[model samples]
Target chain A: MSNHAFIVYKKEIKDMVRDRRMLIAAFGFALLMPVMMGVLYLVSKDSEAEARNTMLALSNIHQAPGLVAFMEKREIDVVEFEGNIVPEELPGKADALLFLPDNYGEMIKQGKVVIGRLYVDENTKLGIQRGREIGSAMDAYSSYVAGIRLLARGVPAAVASPIITSSYDLGNAGFFRQFMGNMILMMMLMAPFVGGLVVAVDTLAGERERHSMQPLLAQPVTARSVILGKLAMVSTFSIVSSLLSVTTLLIAISFIPAGTLPFAVYVNAHTVPLIFIQLIPFSILIAATQLFISIQVKSYKEGQSYISMFMMVPMFVSYLKIFGGEKLADFALFAPILAEMESLGSLFFTGEVSVSHMTSSILVSIIGILVLTWFTSRKLQSEVMLDAA
Target chain B: MIIVKDVAKAYGDVQAVKSVSFHADDAKITTLLGANGSGKTTTLRAISGLLHMDAGSVTVDGMIVADDPVKAQASLGVFPDSFGLYTRLTTREHLAYFGEFHGLSGTKLDAAITEVDKMLNLSEILDRRTEGFSQGQRMKVALARAILHRPSNIVLDEPTRGLDVMNIRLLRTILFDLRKEGRCVLLSSHVMAEVSALSDHVVMMAEGVVCAEGSPAELIARAGEVNLEEAFVKLTGQEDNGERKVA
Candidate 1:
């Protein structure tokens, strides 16, 4: 690189440091990730606790003794009533209402099961789901009750059962950790949009808007040098934000008591380096993508809009993964945001990643960076930068 | 010295410059006179290696600039019509930036800075950032940067477009000094007075082609006009003094 290239790079970095808005935006993004993760963790923890302690209102109290006994045994607080449950009294009164018809026991006794109704508001879905778990326990108890009655009449209980089976998870130690890790990794992928957007926009589009790009482009330096310099600055901010987000997540998980749930939520010291290694390429790809968008637009606002649209792609991909539980294939590992999520998910939950998968994911990310850099360089070569739109 | 041999540039279907040819010798100011969209700026950009010519070549100091732009551009200084300045950089830093591009560093960089600053009369605002500079100040700073490396050839496109009358005179004086230094200075302007006053050689362009070329007095005498502007209008066969009417 020539001194001109270095001067360009130094000038870009200096400008970024001087601009209060860009600095705040970068730090704001870093701070935002931790705060968001912390807020989400708090919300999830609170909801889980609330769900476990939820109370249910029961109607038609006299219909089933086994279910009542099962609820008491499981420490489920149930209030029995004779009529319809009032919606107005639900808040602070019960988490949900279970309406058992008068003929429910009769239907079951006659070997004809009837469907039970659960009345719940939107806010009570989690609690209601937990409350409904009592029904499963009741089913086992009712079968036991029927077997006892059969024994009283000298019939074998085993003859009344069709089959018996037990379930055991075949997943490894890191399975649960990997699942939680995927969520963290997804959050890290999102860091680039939050962290890299402001810097990238300010570097290219902002310069153009300020009318400073012409002199820079006209300098004796090559376009590649300019792009590399800007990309370096953007990636620096992105990596910082990603690391901060991961640290905040790990700290939040540490506050949770051990053995509280199925998944290992804590961030282990051993995994930090590996996670960082995996994340660097992901951040590079995201930074390059945002830079490409910045280069295409004319002003900072347009660059911001372009980056916002680009950000939606990764977010939508993450949403699909979370809600759809899409299975990852070899080919899917080459997809940008999806690949990051999958690799991270595997790294966290399974603690074992196939070498081929890791190689392909990194390859795809590097390829994305290369393609975006090429595009930005090409734009730098155009008269569009010199010609105001 | 600079040489243009049958240079042409196009944008898709529109040909901006059509088989244009001219030569600019050292120790003289060569001004390109034309109406709006007459390919003056396009020709200057082509010579600066900023635009690719569809046909022909631009050679600066015997080095082909357009075909191998990096090498070609290294030997020339270009001051665009509406150049941008880094708002945060002090005038000295701006000069230093361009000076470094031409590989001037250490004592050499310092000497270049001192010389350009003294010549451009930018010593007053050398330490202050350029964020608050007036149009004329900015233009002076840009000119200083263009000549910081003391390149063999200098190409300026409408360098005095927005300057005040006093600054315009100052710029003309500087151009004269550059000509005396035996450096090839190619300037494009619509202002016929400045062109007539400073140019030793004038090339009149019309519709992407050079219609006339000679000394200012010679062109004026040949076109049977007393002033350069009348000679330009006569040579190009266009009226309307190239001025914008305020509403």
Candidate 2:
């Protein structure tokens, strides 16, 4: 940095340090968000484990003693459900509710099909797993009765059910692991934006609102120096916030028992630094984009409106990659946020670097920083900047 | 010396300054005397290289502001119409911040700060944050910020707008001292008494045009008027008590 730019940077840092609110917003989100998300991951993992050992409330258990025995064999503790129904928020006490018909016994005796109802809230990973386990158990019981009926008529079991199907998962990770991986990447990608937003708004737009832009611009320093200095200050917040998130997340990951988390997070000596290397330029890129947005507006409130919208780029792009990634083309991976997600996603989940994706991400970030900072500097030179909003 | 030649500026549809031309010489106090909306601020901004004139040129110390603004700006100290200050920064820090841009730092910057502090009588408020400073205090800090680098030329856009009588007197004295030091001091104001008392040369502007230019007494005599205010009213063709024209 030029001495003039450094001077501006130093002054801006001093100015920002005194704003207790901006410091709190920048640091608090950086330091706390990763830990909170880590705790959430642990809880989700626990819920998945709990789903395997969940209890089933089967209504009319007396009428279906055979089904009760089969559920117990599957290691599910089945209990009677009398005058009860599942609420929308599935209670943790019972993972699933299986309703049996009052005439279950009579229907079986008369060789008529018996109707039953199973209630499960499939909102959470735990609920989905619980529903699958209970449904599989009930299906097994039904098959058992069908096999016995075939034997009584001297029809071989193979004749009645010739093709017994079984499943072998070809995918490496489970549904829960993929979802967790997507979310972790999403959170990591969002860290810089959340970290630098308040400070960036306060620096440019807030300076204008305070009417300090006039005097600053009137100085002998060029607009380029002023913007370069401000960009560095904002990037300090961005990079610090993002690195803290990674650090805390790594710390949180250490608490989990080995091999319990579905995806491997290869956070070792080599990759840890690489993760930082990948994130630093990305953070600066985000800071530059924010400064560009900030210079367009004349007040903090106005700048925030635009910058907050820019923040949604990462989130919306992450969600698009998570839920609808397959529908997107391969080149879309080279798109802004998607490229970052692809590169960082590989580093975090698979402990490998996709060099093409990573390089493109970094190159694009550097170029973006140059372009944005240039545009912002040019904008700062406008005569309109002489006045405040 | 500072020079503005046929400077014309417009804000979109509104023509703010049609044509303004003046010369402010060194070792003299020149005041741009005009009413509100007379484009004094616009012309001052143009000279400070803060605005782009649609027509004409402004030069500070023989350097064209439009061609090389940073060089021109280095020769000029500008106090804008508003006292735009960062409330979170101390008065000394503000001085350092602006002073550093002019290539002042370390002991040099400190020395400049000390110099301005004494000149502006800013001892008591130098270390305090300007968050809740009164108008007088803000004016002092702002003036100190503008002149800390000791530019050869100074341009102030109504520097005494909201100051108390004592602060105004202090500001006038500072202008006098700067002029004595051989620095060209150009200021704008709508107040007639301030213009008559302080201006060694007066450039009377109305509707963005220079209606007349001379010593205050010379202008009164040239317009055949009793005082500077009536000279302004007659020369600019404004009514008794308004910026609007009599016709």
Candidate 3:
């Protein structure tokens, strides 16, 4: 049985290799993630530059000299706006704006709550970070004023604040590493899902549509073996392409200008194999399910459309794991698609993947591969899948 | 020999093959002459174990297809109506793939490819990919792949549907050679001239069952017609030289 499957595998791989153009295209798409990572690094570096010299358009700076001094001390460039400048119009006009309402100094003396609007274009990374810095600086100024008020009332500054709260992050990885973790893992997850899509669909539905599957099925091999052969070929391509993409990402990460980020973003030799290992089972699952859906479709075009749409499922799962910053329920760790992504995240940020999480992920992926392969094999044997029959 | 006995199949509400039965003997070519949707492909599929029959049995070389489809398939070469050629694979590669599929390997696989290549005059195109191959070239590669393993039985569906006169003649010679080697060659075709010229036994099917089974001469006599074409139209209840009613 295995021998026949290997024969099928050899033929499929040969066919795929002969269609080098399609493979090259898939590889190109896989390389996009690494390319995107490089682009993001450049953008982040630019944003870092923007943060150091944050330029905020101030409409009423004369009313808040103390706030102006604090802004200058923090290296925030205070630019004078001569006309009415709206925060919503800040996209191409200015990075951010600080609007101090009229009578702001009188309200401070009267101890009335004064709402100073800090308008920022949240769309840009620099605008968001600079806005955060200005808010914290406002807090520092308010506390400094509170200390003076307490001294006038014959009280020590410690009377106003009893306890100082600070958090100790257990994870020692730098900000860039944590930030790139999602983007990198997202890229890794996408590598197999996107890379293996064409091969998986073409080997089955495309072959059937071209009338080649009939002769293939007529051979002395079992249907299960044929399915296995196709699955093995597609999974191998996906895994290899994902590994290459991961390697490319690592190399790309290494080329990132050192100190461009506050945190170090490194993909060591250990992480490379670990990332590849985490991605393999997911690749197998993707290949199997792709073939499963492709077999059910009538033609290559139909299969392509359906597989492209179906690819969004894994991507959605990966994105959810990346963006859903909340702690996940324990049961979620066993979910096949999300588990691999989360385990990869653990490996990157925490430097140690939880044993239970890894086991669950591996188990779910293996089980998913088996179940999908079984269904695909059953479909391959059915006459509905064999148009020539 | 390939024997199909009372094989009946239905797809949803449509009864495709209702009690179809026939036997193709060794060392002879059997032709299934039918119009469109006459269950010719369905019967072949049943014999190849590609489709399970609702009722009845099919056996290839004493092995029941349902019980031992792999073993039965090993002894039979099926060239479906569609040529089913991989455009990217060269003619030699196509032969090697099927040769390996039938358990041929190493020198045995290489020798089989060379022999089939010589017999089919595929030497000129063996190294060329099949993407731009003509219909005749595609048919030759598909046929060579089917027979590379020297199966005892060969089932071909619509083998001469789109062939030029020269290619048809070449196919005739190949079919004769297979028969002479004691291989059972069962084929389905709509072309009466080729059927009458090549088939030693003709199975006339109409509306999912065998309407008549005999030599071309016998069928012509049974229909009281001068030629096999009129006989086929008459046996299937369709008027000659008129629009064929949809089955």
Candidate 4:
């Protein structure tokens, strides 16, 4: 770095540190974002687990002993329903309600259909999934009875059921797990952006609004030196906030009960350092991008508007990786934010090294910083700079 | 010493400064006297290497501003049209920041600040943030920031605009002292009495061009007027404008 650039860097850092608003903005994202997301993950995980643990309240249970026994064998805890005939909501601990008629057994023995209604809450996704599972189990019991009836009639049961198929989930992660997992990665990537945003806008656009750019540019320093100094200052905030976010999340993860999070988190010492290593240059790249955006506008408010818009780039890329990652080609998936997610996902959940993705992220980050810094520095010399509003 | 040879600049289709030319020699106070919108600020900015001239060149201490702005800027200390103080920084800190840009640091930097503080009576606000500083205190810091590096040429645009009478007198003394040290001092203002009192040579600008130039007495004599203000009105033909302020 040039001496002039270093001087600018030091002054900007000191200036930023003394600003209470900047400090709050920088630390707030680092401290609160991860904890909030972690809490959300825990809630989703518990709800999913609750959905899987089926509890059914069966009405007229005495007339359906075989059905009740079948449900108990299938691990659906069955309880007697004694109060309201038609409850608006599920009874205290029941995931669903199974209604049976008084002549249910008699109809079965007479070979007539026994009609019943299964009321399951469809308010939440978890509710819908639980309802589907309960309906599937009831259908299985009905098929079992028909097979038995067929065998007693001297007809081959195999004739009734020609195809035999079973299912096994290929992936261990559940629906809520995958969603929260993608969310966590997005939060981690966004932490640095939120951290540096205030400082980035203030450094260039704020200076211009204050008309300080005129005096600073009047000095002997080159625009390159001035921009480099600002870029370094913004990167300082970005790196600190991002690293703090990772560390806070690591500590938060350590405190959670084992196997509680819906998704896997492999935050050991090795992966933690690797995650930091990936983020340092990536945070710098984000800093350059933000500074580049901030310089295009002439006022602090205007710069904030543009830089906030630039923030959407990360969010858009993160969402693409989360939802469309599988459908996206490898080249698209290995872009900046996507590449970072791919590497961090492994370091975070799978405990496998994604070296190619990591290398690509770092290389792309370096190239991006250089290109953005070049453009931003050139913009500093534009004639409009001389006549700020 | 600074020289502007037929410098021209424009914004869009509107010409801000057109074919302006002048010389500021060492050991002399040369003031650009003009009415508002007379392009004084643009001329000062061109000398400071802050703008790219459309048609001509600016050279400070034998270095061309357009060809090598840094070298040209190193030889010039500029007080821009606005004080542009950083409200978060102290007077001393502001001095150090601009001082460092000029390659001043450590004991040398400290000595420069101490010296400037003594000259500008900045001891009271040296360590205080500039957030609530009075106009006079802000002017002191801005002037100190400009001259801390001891450049060969000092250029100020309306430096005394918001200062009280006392601060203006103090600034006048400093400009005279700088001239005594053989530094070229170029400044712009329309206050007739101030221009008459401070300038050894005056370049009168009207509508982006030099309307008149010479010593105050010489211009007054040339325009067949009794006072410098009368000479200004008769020379620039600003008699019909409502914005002329001779005071």
Candidate 5:
């Protein structure tokens, strides 16, 4: 930084510190995404515990004693229902209800299969768990009956089932990492943008609106120096905010009950610095682009409105990695927000950080910063922007 | 010394300033006297290098403002019309910022701040934020910022516009003191009394053109008017109500 630029930076920092409303607004934005993630963790934790201990309401239990025995052995507690007709809607008396027909015994005697009705909302967590439990128990009881029938015909019971199937998960990180990783991606994408917002607008449009631009510009300082000073100030604040946000989120994730989730929830110590390094170019890009747009507008309010509208572009782009998933094109690695999102996903989920993908993303962001810096410096020199004050 | 030669500026078809020129000599006070829309502000902006001229050039202390704006700006201390103070900064911080921007640092920067504070009688409010500042208080900080670097030339755009009697007198004393120190001081004003009292040289503008240029007495003699105000009205060809003739 030039001497003049440093002077301006120092003054701006002090000025920003004294501005209560702006500080509060900035602090609020910093906390927004992390707080949202914390709330999500709490809600998911409650439902997960409920799913572990599912309850079932079984009707006409005497007709399917064998099926009832299987459910009970699996630690699924049952409440008996003795009505001749099953209720249309399962009364909210239990998580889910199983309705066995009076003809269930007759069907079994005739060597026929009987389909028992399972009533559940399927939307609630407990309801879904109960439904899965009843379905698995029914499958088990039917297979046992088939084995007995096969032995009675003078055939080996093993002939009925020659193959046994099981699944092996290939991923080391559980859905916990992927789920939290997505949230972290969104927060990282927004961090630079939200952090630099007020400072960028204040240095450009705010100065213009307050009629301070003329005197400030009239100094011996070069236009480029002025621009650099403002950009440096904004970028510093953005990087700090991003670091704080990610650290807070990581700490919050650590508090989550590890046993409740299928995968462990923890962030590696080295990952924090790597994430911050990835954000450096993004912070500079956001600072430059925001300042460029801000200097064109006439007032702080006008700049804010334009910037807020422009933010939707990056915001929508960030979500492409989530919704598009693996279906995204190979060239997505060279895109701006999409590339960052993909890199973040890989880093957290697979614990695999692709140097090629990250390098391309950083290079693109740096190019964006250069282009915006050119325009912003030009704006500072332009008589139109100066005279507007 | 600052010289603006035949500078013209136009905003599309409006032509805000046309064929304006003036010289502010060392150790003297020069004023641009004009009515509203007569281009006083535009002329000042053009000379300050804030507005690029459509034609001609501005030379500050021997450097052309157009060719080397930074070097030219280094010699100028400018107080623009309707200047804004950063409401969140203390008065001393404002001065220190300008001082450092002008390349002063260390003890020199601190000394400059102290000097400006003393010169402007800003000690009482030096540590306070500028929010809710009175007009006079704001002017004090703005003027201090303007002169903190102690440039060879000082330019003020209607510095006394909103000042009360005491504040106006204080500004008058400061301008006189600055001139006594051999610095060229230039200001723009429409108030005839202030122009007559403080200006060693007056450039009277009308409709974006210099209608007259001379000392106050010389302008009075040239217009054959008894007073400077009457001379100003006669030279600009305006009625007492400040309206111009159809021609």
Candidate 6:
């Protein structure tokens, strides 16, 4: 490195360390990941435990004997309530209240039946969903009773029920992984916004505010060296932050109980390394994007706002993929944050690795860095530096 | 020596500096005297390669400033009116950082630091961070960094703009010593007394153009005034009522 470039880098690092806010921000990010994940893990575990221990109340009025028998077999306490059940006690005393309305059996016999209402607290959506599962069991018992009654009348149950439909998920393990990978994808996408913003704002806008940019620009160093030095410092912070975040997430996952669901939370050792390998290019893209934004803005506050606005890009992309049911196209896998999200989803849910996808991601990040460097260099060469000075 | 040949700087349609030219030879303190918006700082910035000129060229040590900015910058040291010091760096670190930028290191860097420290009288606060330093101390530190490489050309824009009488005298004595070392010093200030006391050559500017150029005595004689201040007012076409105070 040139002496001027080395001095610039050393000074920047010194300033970053000395500034309490920067240190707090960098360390705070690292601290935030572990602490946040730990808290979330504990809260989730507590909630699951609470749910499992909860007792539910089932009320079947004019109910078929078979449905009643099934409830008894399942050990669900049947409470015969004529009027509205106590709303406040539903959450604490009962997980959910099952309400079987009048003439339910007659309606089933007529071959046209209405499902009973599952009374639950609106705030407890999870409890309501669980109540529906119990309701489905009751429906199965009702159907069995009606089928036996039809057989006794010399009419085939198949004749009465002419149409039958069933559904199955055709997607492989990769698709399942992608579904569960949303959270990781979202976090990985956020890496650029979080890491780049801090580095860029401190490197360019902060220097301008401090009135040190003039002397820095007046040095005999090339503009490229100046920018690269700044990018290296900021990228170091970002990469460290990303690694810490991923580690914290992994630690949190380790606390999850085995056999909690169909999928495993424990990532394979190889998977962890692969995710980190993919993150390298993603972090570079983030740092470059942030540096570009930081150099364009005149103040740290403006840089912060720009970063916040850019943060929305990843969030929007994730939402579009999830709720919008948008399939990830091959081309989308090359778009910076989008690529990381898709790659993370693949890695976590299916344990699948796409070398082509990884290569494309690397190329995209390189292009992003090049474009950002060009514009930043042009800005450095312009009168903007003088005005900033 | 530093030479500016017909330099003009324009920002959009507004010309900040208009075809102004002058030269500062070694062993002389040349002062650029002008009113507000008179393009004195613009001229200094152009010489420092901080601003690009629309026409003509600036040469320091026979190297064109705009064409070979790095070489020209290496040969010159610029000290603006307001010196900005890094709050996180100590006085010694600040000097060392700039010394490294000028390609001085190891024993040479240490010797340069020692020389600038003694010259600027900053040895007492060498280890202290500059966050709590007084304005005079900051100015001294800035001067120390600028002269660490001992460049042949020194450009100062209002170096004593804000200073106590004692500090101002101290800075003037330092500038006198710098001049004795056969270094070309380009100074810009509105203070008539300071300019008259220190400047060997005076270039008066008005509306971004050189209105008059000569020695302090020559300008005074040419303008038919008793001192350089009245001469500045006369050359720039300002009414001189003789009521302006000189500190």
What's the lDDT for candidate 6? 0.76
Off by over 4 Å in 6: A1-3, A37-56, A60-65, A72-96, A100-125, A154-180, A260-269, A325-330, B240-247
TM-scores for chain A over all candidates: 0.81, 0.90, 0.82, 0.93, 0.87, 0.81
DockQ of 6: 0.61
Return the top candidate by TM-score. 4
lDDT of 6 at A332: 68
Q: Which residue pairs overlap in candidate 2's backbone? A: none
Residues B95-210 of candidate 5: C-alpha lDDT, one tens digit per residue: 88888878888899888988988898899999998899999999999899889989889999999988999999999999999999999999999999999989999999988889
For candidate 1 chain B, which ten residues in a row score worst on lDDT? Answer: B238-247
lDDT tens digits, residue span B122-179, model 3: 9889999999999999999989988999999999999987899999999999999999
Poorest lDDT segment (10 consecutive residues) of candidate 6 chain A: A172-181
Q: After TM-score superposition, what is the CA distance of residue B82 in candidate 4 from its true location, in Å?
A: 1.0
Off by over 4 Å in 2: A42-54, A58-67, A81-124, A260-262, B241-247
TM-score of each: 0.87, 0.93, 0.88, 0.96, 0.92, 0.89
lDDT of each: 0.77, 0.88, 0.82, 0.88, 0.81, 0.76
Write the number of the candidate with greater TM-score, choosing between 1 and 3.
3
- The predictions' CA RMSDs to the true structure, in order, are 4.4, 2.6, 3.8, 2.4, 2.8, 4.0
DockQ of each: 0.47, 0.82, 0.80, 0.82, 0.79, 0.61
lDDT, residue B225, model 3: 97
Candidate 5, residues A1-389: lDDT per residue as tens digits?
88777877788888787777767656566676667876776665455446555567888777777766777787776778878576776655566787777788888777787777777767655456567766766667677788887888888878987765544668754445455566667877787788878878888999998988889888888888888888888888777777777777676667666775444433586666677778788778888888999989988898999888877877677566555555777886568887777776667556677687788879988889888988899888887766553
Please provide, for model 2 over B1-247, each residue's C-alpha lDDT reduced to its tens digit, 9 standing for 90 to 100.
9999999999999889999999999999999999889989999999988888899999999999999999999999989888888989989888888888888989999999999988989999999999999999999999998899999999999988889999999999999999999999999998999998899999999888999999999999999999999999998889876755756
- lDDT by residue for model 4 (B1-247), tens: 9998899889899898988999999999999999888889999998998888899988899999999998889888989988888888888889999999888999999999999988888999999999999989988999999999998999999888988999999999999999999999999999999999999999999878888899999999999999999999888777666354353
| Candidate 4 CAPRI grade | high
Mark the regions of model 5 whose C-alpha exceeds 4 Å error after superposition.
A29-34, A46-54, A73-77, A82-95, A124-133, A136-140, A143-177, A257-266, A387-389, B239-243
Interface RMSD of 1: 1.9
Q: Which pairs in model 1 have colliding backbones?
A: A174-A349, A177-A348, A177-A349, A178-A348, A178-A349, A179-A349
Clashes of each: 6, 0, 1, 0, 0, 1
1 or 6, greater by TM-score: 6
Which of 1 and 3 is the better model by DockQ? 3
